[model samples]
Target: MYHLPSSPTIRVLDRFSTLPDEYADDDQLVSFWPLLSAILLRPVSTTKDVVDALEEIAHVLRQSTGPAGDYGTLSKVLNALTFIDFPPGPHPGMTLRLSRSQAACLVAHQFLTSLASPRDRSEYYDFGIWYDSEQPHPRAAEMYITAMCVFFADLPDINILEEYATRDLEMGGGVSYVLASAPARSVGNTPMSPFRVLHNDVHVTGPHSPSSMDPNGALVVAANKVIGFGKSATGEEVTLGTTPEACPAVLVTPVLTGDQVVVITGASPVLRVTGERRNVAWEIPDTRTASADFDAWRMHRAGGPLLLMDALELDEHVSELGQVPDLVPENIEREVHKATTSFMATAATTVYTPLWGCGAFCGDPAVKMCLLWLAASMASVELVLLLDARGQALADELEPFVRRWQEKTAAELRQWLGRVPRTLRGGQVLAYIDT
Candidate 1:
């Protein structure tokens, strides 16, 4: 089971399993492979056991070279491993328990931080994932592999990520949106301000995307079979890249770290197309912390919701080669409903989406565009659609997409729902009525 095809940890271990130095030699770093593999076993294992294993790794890190290194780097990640109160959110109960599985992951990440730096973003590597087989979307395996090596092997510098965002905006990435025109806040261009939206309105907007790895609300990103954030190969996957932003920001920015890992893991897969996207619902403890630097200076991670919608299938191991869970109207409806509820609950002004299921996952853009509009129409939040930097393709797909729902009266909308083709709708959505 350690190498279970469906397990994120197994995928992680497999990547390193072949690396002689990482696992074979003494003091090579992966001295705890057996325990680490054991921690990721499914049929869900005990949390305390994983915690114990992590503590042992911590002991090694503390005694190895130095415990608290420069930037208190080791210390920062170590602190992130401790069990602190989960920030307040729509999922309050989920927040309370940082689950054993998550703890194992946090500790593994600390091991990485001790080896790397924030700006280095070790992903600054010389090579890519050379697949033993055709690695269609190597990101899934890469993400899990990287997760196991967070502070050690390779990490993408966060500042570089910000720079990427600015360049994307400037070049307009073959496509453009509403947010590009809006000025990047003076202090936090990388991590923009998150705001609350109480007013009921649908605004066609863009320029910013939750996928950009910076926004602080419920983020929507695709996941690989292992559920790691490395789903996007070119680093263009907005949701996946942005998923780590909130937690790491909180980890380094003292005001936000409540002595807990900034990550949140849902009890089950948030969206299981073929395999789980792992436990990546993030809740940084930045509920009340704000600065003159931040736009929604007062609104933190708790205030903003990061919604991770599992909308892709990169697991060649799953089923028929390209058969992915179709983002039918139902799945889209379900995701939108949850996102709307979270934003509404928190008064999050917008949901900066990057064509939720339209990327490598391959959801029909016209359909996704239509459904996205409907969902935002239903929720009435200012739905910000960020045609990503490389989203010329997506923009083209959505070119003919018309927000026709805005003109439809509630009664008429309901009637259209009934006549919609079977290909366009599903029962889960059929059962949902605004009233």
Candidate 2:
């Protein structure tokens, strides 16, 4: 058997007058809060006593008829509390018979979850609790209203209220201020996936890669003609063989007017083309072939020629070369002409690299790692083109990548969460009140 504290009805009236005007129309005052608050504030001397108090509040609220004005407030409060289903439990205390205005206050208070300090209370009121001052989302307003109710209901002292108002206005405005500044977009609506560039031709080789080429390994060449150009105007060719040097290099016969054959080898060292010199490295006064000289090479042809050399080096060469090979007379003339024409036509064009897609919810470490891997992979592709240009095909490729990553990540998360212990299992509700 349960028991309710004496003067339960008077307690309700006292608390009702203290509710904020923001919840004037809320209805849950009679329907839920009195029972909930009693349950929350009641002592746990005997479980049966608490149950009796809860049953009394529920019985009184259900049978008692409220005036029209009070009923409207109760309706609003009830509507909001209905969002959260209350588990069956015993309650004890002076069960408050909340009026319509008080119900509204309870509804508003339940929504605010972030308010930490007393100062936040005044800031919340200044924002007009229900007014849509922050993000356009309805949840934001609902949260403010709920938090205020919880704060007032839990601590009903006037001194506490004054302290909260003063602190909120002075002490960094608390969590309500943060909520007011947050964007209204739903958690799931945030942009997580990035543009991902997909290309089968390009592959990156470095210390991070599982298969790093030996420093002294023989150079591997792929024979591929420039069939198309990337968004950066860099050439794209289907790799033809393991040894492109072995095959006859196709002479790019330039048909454009004012095009001159320029033989650009490693590091863009403009080889001096004389009738006497064939595949000879000429020492130009200003041009020097060093690690730092790669930047000068990238500036030409949207870095197409430089990208090709990098691709070749990643796949084939492991060690630094002493000198760049000068092609035969016909090959040199043809390459130089192609380079000159391509540069003139598309020098101003820009290249775009695509970022990879991410899972819906990723922890900090996982997100960082995922981004790092994505960046490395995009660099490996060497295709400075907008993946969207490929449209549906590019999107299709991303699906598998995202799926594999999500599965791997989810498994790890589940394993971690599994270690947490569950306390409640039986029908008896072991409610603990922090006093």
Candidate 3:
């Protein structure tokens, strides 16, 4: 039977203290670290023992999260899990927004089941990178062990603490999600919001993989899979094309269709406790320092709403584009334009975005920024672009255009983008405007 989750009950415990004997009466409350310590410390004699260890991990997760109420088992706490119950895919002109309690419940459900899938664990589990690496990443074992200790202790109350911390944001209409479409060609005088750059990762609160230096780590992709817990599974992957671009938990929302842009406001700037870059913070893992990385994410477990849009995975198409390493074709710019306008046109608030599609996706920063700027002008919503140090330089190169074109209407900018020389470099494409 299915059940809906409610607000998590907060129970405080001494951070450095050992498991107390008196608390044994509460089946719902499990001391996360001690149980894990016991499970890992035991010996594994055979392949069967290894399998049993995985089961033990799942059992521990179920115990820690506990059941929803008198009738709920922790594993069954969510209203739905498989795609059969929670349908996925983009629903144009629809919006699927969830309350804080509902979002937490969905995350909790993913915590219970996502790790159990062997395919998921094999491919996406952050810790697995360290485990399977032939020449393991530097200090891989230490990073894993430290994360195991600190991350779990923070889980039970993560949602409640986040709610308490972000109460002010929640009161101010909380996070809003809207899927918007491209702007019409007949643009008017929609004054663009001033653009600013910051040397930081996107403000969405989540942990990255320190060992391998990957930004979209457990916190971002799999909802804190770094904690090293899982439920047993029937060995099937989540059906493709029926899920969100990020974690399956995003499927929590009910209405998903609308315009082309998926704009989210009030996205929590997850508190940054370590060096801003993943490579800087996670490159040389130390037990003393690694725990802080997990703590940073732990403090903001109840994150704000996220806009789910997938960049074109351009790395795979390098063969088609030939020698121009960073060139963005005209079709690609349209996709970026669609992504920006949907959110900009409808939302009544400013949008915060990272350098979209510039990382592993291989997008050109200048092209992306131009497309976003044009789309926002059409929609008339303010746009704030988040950037790392490298992006700061690119922003500097483009600021001149931003100032010069401040008076240009959306229709004018759209026409300029259409005529952009595809052969010109991404940054150089904007330089053509002066000629």
Candidate 4:
């Protein structure tokens, strides 16, 4: 019911008109017109002439290519026809008719023949024809399939078509295109800064405790330096410390070593460092010790100070990170949910309702066509969900309807879903969802 532009026919005619007489012979012209017309619009009758003409046009269109070649000329003619004024209605030999505006637009496209080219010969075939071919153009076939389900009133056959379109779109780099544009932050491209550690010593006038720095002896401490900083993938830098003017650092005193581990402790403002590093390492005592007690413990007292840096680097990176772009899966899920809910609601209301009171309803083909689109869109969502176990929840609710429809269509739905026909002894219904 939706009016397609007559440009296809007009362009073909325009191309014919522009051709040299030899190429535009009456036999070829007349033969080409009907064929092109049939290709552009669905044939109204099963007559041999209409069918033969369409077959010939399709053959030629499929093989035509190159500059000013048969394909190029045909494309030009079709483009011109897009702008012609043509009436819409049930035509004598066409399944659908074009409106005046649509026709005129087709005709106008003829003038823009520069847009036509034989190089892309695959664009001519529609879904019905393309699917019937053993070797169809990947892109053209996909578009044709989607167009049939989406633009034509072919709700019953949309499931397979929709899947084919989705798969092709995914393969044609659509998902990667979206992901490549996503934004995120990384820590490999940031600045590093220094930090510090401090130690304190104490002297006790008590008895000589083994002549070494013990809890009752003198204690000596030293200061060590370290730095802390953060970075981002974009090369941005952030420094960590008490003051922006100074590097971040920690101080400790009275380093103790035992059990192959070092321990440092303090009082009031207790500071402990633990761990081992080849060049520089610091350890914190397992037990709390007052600054006074720590000051008294020493034996050739050693002060080890290690820096606390990059601890918050990962955290900073995560905080600065951006969201990823939406991909096909997410997009499809959203559309499917929206469409499915609407269709289910409508089907629930209409399938069992009586038609006696539905009077004076406009039987406009356009309205019917729109309804068909809604049905197909809904069905497409259902079919996709059927391929995954996750859809079981939805499928359970629709099982009754699905079974009924399957029975009515002679299992056409199941066949399209890649299951064997019902007549097959080993035919099995595949689980709709991934386990």
Best by lDDT: 3
Candidate 4 per-residue C-alpha lDDT over 1-435 given as tens digits, one digit per residue, 9 for 90 to 100: 211333233223333233345544454442344434434454343223333333344345433321222332223223333222222321212112122112112222221121222222322212122323232233332222222222122111223323333432333211110000111111121211111111222111101112222232111111111122111100001111101111101111111111011111111111121111111111222332212221132111122111111111111222222311111223222322322232233112111100100112211211111122233333331211111232243334334433444323312331233332222111122233110
Model 1 vs. true fold: TM? 0.36
Q: Return the TM-score for each candidate structure.
A: 0.36, 0.17, 0.50, 0.19
Residue-level lDDT for 254 in candidate 4: 17
Sorting all predicted structures by lDDT, with the top scorer first, yields 3, 1, 2, 4
Quote the lDDT for 130 in model 1. Answer: 18
Residue lDDT tens for model 2, 1-435:
111223233223223333344423454243234434544454444434433443333234323221111222222433454222333432222212222122223222222111111221212211222322233333323332333333223322333333344343343221110000111111121222232334432232111111222221111111122211111111121111111111011112121232321211111112121111111111112331222222222222011121121111111321334312111223223332332232222122221222211111111212222332332232222113222233344345444444544323322322222332222111110111000
Q: Which stretches of candidate 2 lie over 4 Å from their true place?
A: 1-44, 64-162, 174-435
- The local distance difference test score of model 1 is 0.31
lDDT (Cα, tens digit) per residue for candidate 3, span 286-376:
3222123423443233233344445555576565544333344444455445455444443234444666656656667777676666656
Go through the candidates in order and give each one's C-alpha lDDT: 0.31, 0.24, 0.39, 0.22
Q: Which stretches of candidate 3 lie over 4 Å from their true place?
A: 1-101, 114-189, 200-305, 314-333, 345-348
Candidate 4 deviant stretches above 4 angstroms = 1-5, 13-52, 59-336, 339-341, 344-347, 350-435
Tell me how far the alpha carbon of residue 214 in candidate 2 is from the true structure, in angstroms, after superposition. Answer: 42
- Stretches of model 1 off by over 4 angstroms after superposition: 1-109, 112-219, 224-226, 231-305, 312-345, 388-404, 409-418, 422-435
The TM-score obtained by model 2 is 0.17
Q: Candidate 2 or 3, higher TM-score? A: 3
